[model samples]
Target: MSNETPLPLVMLRAVVSGGCDVTPPQRPLTPSGRN
Candidate 1:
């Protein structure tokens, strides 16, 4: 197999800790999926 790591475990930790360092974003990107 090739050599490439996944993007879940690390991402989860990074985001989890990152959130604690900042207030909630003004607002999430916003729901722009529906038409």
Candidate 2:
């Protein structure tokens, strides 16, 4: 078996992590925009 993650999953993880980093600081200022 190959020990490798699919490309889509890798991209998804990157996006999620980046979103978490960006969202927190923006959440307070735009509480109504981000849910």
Candidate 3:
């Protein structure tokens, strides 16, 4: 379980960081348009 846990944790962190960087710029555009 310990070994399996680290693998997914690393992948999730990578994906989360990537998504955050990509999403933040795009998010403002949509909300600004609505506002």
**What TM-score quantifies how close candidate 3 is to the native fold?**
0.50
Q: Which model is ahead, 2 or 3, in terms of TM-score?
A: 2
Compare the candidates by lDDT and give the number of the best one.
Answer: 2
Q: Give stretches of model 3 more than 4 Å off.
A: 1-5, 27-35
Alpha-carbon shift of residue 21 in model 2 (angstroms): 1.0
Error of 1 at 15 (Å): 0.3
Judged by lDDT against the true structure, how good is candidate 2? Answer: 0.80
Model 3 over residues 1-35: C-alpha lDDT tens digits?
76677877989999999987788676776664446
- Candidate 2 vs. true structure, TM-score: 0.56
Tens-digit lDDT track for model 1 on 1-35? Answer: 13454577668868888875443453445544432
Deviation of model 3 at 23, angstroms: 1.0
> Backbone collision count in every prediction?
0, 0, 0
lDDT of 1: 0.57
Among all windows of 10 consecutive residues in model 1, the one with the lowest summed lDDT is 26-35
Put down candidate 2 lDDT per residue, 1-35, tens digits, no spaces.
Answer: 24598888888999999998888777686665555
User: What clash pairs does model 2 have?
Assistant: none
* Candidates ranked by lDDT: 2, 3, 1
lDDT of each: 0.57, 0.80, 0.78
